[model samples]
Target: MGRFGKLETDVHIKASASKFHEILHKRTHRISNVSTDKVHGVDLLEGEWGEVGSIICWRYFHDGKARVTKERIEAVDKQNNSITFTVIEGDLTEKYKSFKFNIQCIPKEKGSVIHWVLEYEKLHDEIPDSHSMLQFCVEMSKDIDAHLMEGSEEPYHNDISGQKCEALSINKSKKRHVWHCLIFLGLNQNTMGRFGKLETDVHIRASASKLHEIYHERTHHISNVSTDKVHGVDLLEGKWGEVGSIICWRYFQDGKARIAKEKIEAVDKENNLITFTVIEGDLMEKYKSFKFKMQFIPKEKGSVIHWVLEYEKLHDDIPDSHTMLQLCVDVAKDIDAHLMEGSEEP
Candidate 1:
C-alpha cells in the first residue's frame, strides 16, 4: 500500500484576489515547465486551458534525461476562484505513486492569500521530500505577481485613444481638466480658432433645483446680450425650467446671424451641480467641429461656474477663440457679483 504525504503553505500577496486570479491565468505555465540545463528544451502541451477537465503535458530534462508528465485539471470554480491539478499519467509514475496540487485564493483588504496544497506518495520509503518543487512554485508566484503589477510594455486597446485625461482640482471635491489634439484638419492655434477644450469636475453644496435656477438665470441673461457689434436677438429655449433641458441662441454677426444650441448633459441635485453639452447649432457650422460643456457648482460660501469649449477652426484667419473665453469669464464674474449682492434676479 502507498502512504500519502502532504505539504501545505500559505502566502499573503499584496494584490487583490481579482488581480491574483488575472496573474495566475496569464502566467501559470512558467511554473509547470522547468528545465535542468541550458541545453535542455522544456515546454508545456496545452488543451482547453483554464477550465475544468483541461489537460497539460510537460516535457523537460531531469537527471540528464528527458521526462514528461501529463496533468489533468480535476476541478475549477470561478466563484470560489480555485483550481486543482492531478497527475494522471507521466514517466515518473513508477517513481511517484500519486500526486495532486491544489491552489485556493481568498480576497483580503489590500491583497489576497494563496493557499498551496501538495500531496504525493513515493515508491520507496527513503524518497526525499519535494521541497525544491514547493520552492519553485512560490518563486514563480512572485514572478507572475511582479509581471502583472508592472504590466506589459505594449500599449493596450484603451491606450490607443491616448493617455487618460489628467484631473485638476477646482474645489475640495471638484476637479477639472482639458484635452486638445491637432489632427490632419489643422493646427490647434489660438489664431486658428481651434484652441484646446476644457472639461470640468464640480461638486456643489446646494440642492439641484436651486442650482438649476441659477444656471437658467445666468445663461439666459448672457444670451440676451449682443455677441458682436451687430444687433440680433439671441433667444434660448427648451425644457427651459428644468434639468436635462436645452437652450438655443441666435447671435447676429455682420448683416446675417448664426444659431447655437446646448443640452443639459448631467445634473446632480444632491450635489447642486449641472453639466450641459453643446449638441447642435451655428458653432458647429462655423467650425469644422465644435462642442462645449458647462458645469455649475454651489458652495457654502459661494458657488463656481465652470466652462469648457472644444472647437476646430474653419479657416486660418479666424484667430484663436480667446474672445469666447473672455466672454465666459465675464459671465462668471457677473454671476458672482450678483450672488454676493444677495440678488436672485439676473
Candidate 2:
C-alpha cells in the first residue's frame, strides 16, 4: 500500500460560516485579487462551481518557481458547510498517488472556526509527508478569511518569499516573503492574537552580520532618517543593539511626532533572527502592546531582510497600519539606496 498522511487544522476568524463556505463555492476565482503577489490567477476549467465533478485551475508562484494545479469538486454538503476537492493533475500528482481536501466550518462561541483535512497517498516511500502542503492549506484558509473580513477595506499585499521567488499559490494563498495581519483590539475582540511580517530583497546586500549591525546599532546615524519617516532613534537603556537592549524611536506619524520604547527580547546571530518587544511610549498609549523583529536570511544572489510587527489596536477606528507599514517599507528603500550611494554597509 502507498504511504498515506492526513493533516487537520482549525483556525478561528471573525466571519460567518455560511459566507465563508459560499466564497469557497462561488468566488474561488477572486483569490488572486486578495493575494496578488502569490496567486497570479485562478480560472474555471470545466463544468460549474459548487457542482460535483467541476474542474478549476490555479496559477501560482512558490519557492522561486511558478506552478499549477487542477482540481475537481468531489463532494459538497451544504448543511455542514463542507466541500471536498480532489487533485486530478499538476504538482501534487507528480509524487502523490492521489490527494484531496475536506473542509468544514463550525460556529464557535465567538466568530467561527475553519476546519481543514488533507488526505494524501504518496507514490513512493521516499516521498515525505505533506507538511508544507498542510501549511499551504492553513495559509489559504487565512487568506480567504481575511478576504471575507476585509469587506470594503482596500486590498493589501504582503510580500511573499524572497525576491525572485514566490511559491505556487491558489486563490490568494501562499506568499514567498510576506504575510497579512489583522489589526486587533483588546482580548475581548482578539482572542486570537494577530501579527504582520514584512520582507524585502536587498540588492547589493550586506552579509547577515553586517546587515544586523546596521539595522540594530547604527540606524540613528543614517542621514536620510528624517526623510524615511524617522527623525531619530536614541539608545535609552542597556547596550545598544544587543539582547536586553532598550531603544527609543522618535518619529513622525500622520504629521505628528511620536515616540516608542522597545526592548530587544531575543537575537539569533547564527540564523539572523531578532525579536524586539515594544514596552512603552506613545505607541503603548495607542496600542495595547507591540513587538518588532528582523531576520536576515542569506540567498545566492543577495540577501532577504524581514521585518515583523506584532501589536494590538486600541480601537476599531484607529485606522489600519497600511500607512505605517508603508513608512517602514519606505525606510528600508531609502536605507538601501543610501547605503549603495555611500559604498558602506549598515
Candidate 3:
C-alpha cells in the first residue's frame, strides 16, 4: 500500500463569501467532453448541495475507460466558509482506498482567497503516482473559482421562496413636451456662431509617438505638456501629468491668432478620457469659467473622438455655446480626415 497523495491551490476572487457560497451550493451541470481525459463528466448525484449529507459524483476517464466515483459531504461550516467531502463509493476504490477533498475561503481586502485541498490513499505500491490526478484537481478547482466569480457579474437577484427573483419595476408618466423644449432651447439660446470650423477628409496617419511629439511642441509653453495635448502629453514626456498642468493653445480665427490657457481637470488612461478648464485669453475674459472634456474611444480600426464644452456666459446677449460646439465638431471632422488620409499612405 502507498501513502495518500495531496494537491492544493489558492486563488483570490472579487466577491463576498456569501455570494461565493451561494454559487457553489447551487447544483449545476458539469463538464461533459473536454480535450483532457481526467474529467469525463460531473453530476449532482443525491441530496441538495451545501447539506452535510449531499453527494456529488464525478465520472473520470482513466486507462482508456470511464470510471464513476461518488463523494458525500462529511462536514459543512458556513461561518468559517469551509466544506469537507469524503469519497464514499465508486471505481476510485480500485486505485485509491479512500479520498477526501476540502475547500475553504479566507476573507481578504475587497475579496476572498479560496484554498483547495485534496487527499487520497493508494491501494498498491505498483500504482502510478497521483501527479496526474492532482493536476486535474487543481485545474478543476480553478474552473470552479472562475464560475463562482462569474456570478458576481450578474445583476443582483432577490431570493423569495428559495427561488431567485428580479426586482419589480415602477412606471412613471413622461415629462411634458414643454419642459423638454424649454430645457434644450434655453441651454442653446445663442443666435450667432462665433467659432468657425474647417473639416477636410485628408489622411494624416501618425503614430501615437509622433502625435504626442506634435502635441507637446504645440503646448510646451504651458506648465505640463503631457496632460494638455489632444493625444496625451505623457506619451512624449514622463508620467506625473496631474491637475494644474498648464495647457497652451493658439488658433487662427478670421486672420487673428486666438490664445487660451487650459488647466487639466482629470485624466483616466484606462478610459481614455480627459477634462480641462479653459480660460480664453483674447475673447474668453468675459466668461466666468469654461470647461470641456474629450474622450478617445477605440473602434474597429480607428478611434472616435468626442469633445464636450461647458461654459457660463458673462452676458445674456453674448449667445449660447451651441455654435462653439458645432465648430468643435467641424474641427474634429477635419482631424479625422487627416488621420484617415495618413493611414492610407503606408
Best by lDDT: 2
* lDDT of candidate model 1 versus the reference: 0.50
Q: Which candidate number would show the highest TM-score if scored against the true structure?
A: 2
In angstroms, how far off is 90's CA in candidate 3? 2.2
lDDT of each residue in 198-270, candidate 2, tens digit only:
2323333445666666776775665344464787778888887688888888787777988878888998877
Candidate lDDT (C-alpha), each: 0.50, 0.65, 0.49
Q: In model 3, which runs have C-alpha deviations exceeding 4 angstroms?
A: 13-16, 28-41, 60-66, 148-346
Q: lDDT of candidate 2 vs native?
A: 0.65
Q: Worst 10-residue stretch by lDDT in candidate 1?
A: 154-163
Q: Which portions of model 1 show Cα errors greater than 4 Å?
A: 23-47, 59-67, 91-94, 153-346
User: Which window of 10 residues has the lowest lDDT sum in candidate 3?
Assistant: 176-185
What's the CA error at residue 49 for candidate 3, in Å? 2.6
| lDDT tens per residue, model 3, 1-346 | 1244454545445556665554445432333322234665556666775678877776667556777667787887888888787877776666666667777776766566566666666665455444445445544544555555665443233221122112222222221100000001122214212221111111122333333222223334222221122322222223335566665555543345566667777776666667767754654755666776666555454544445555655664554343444444444444444545654321
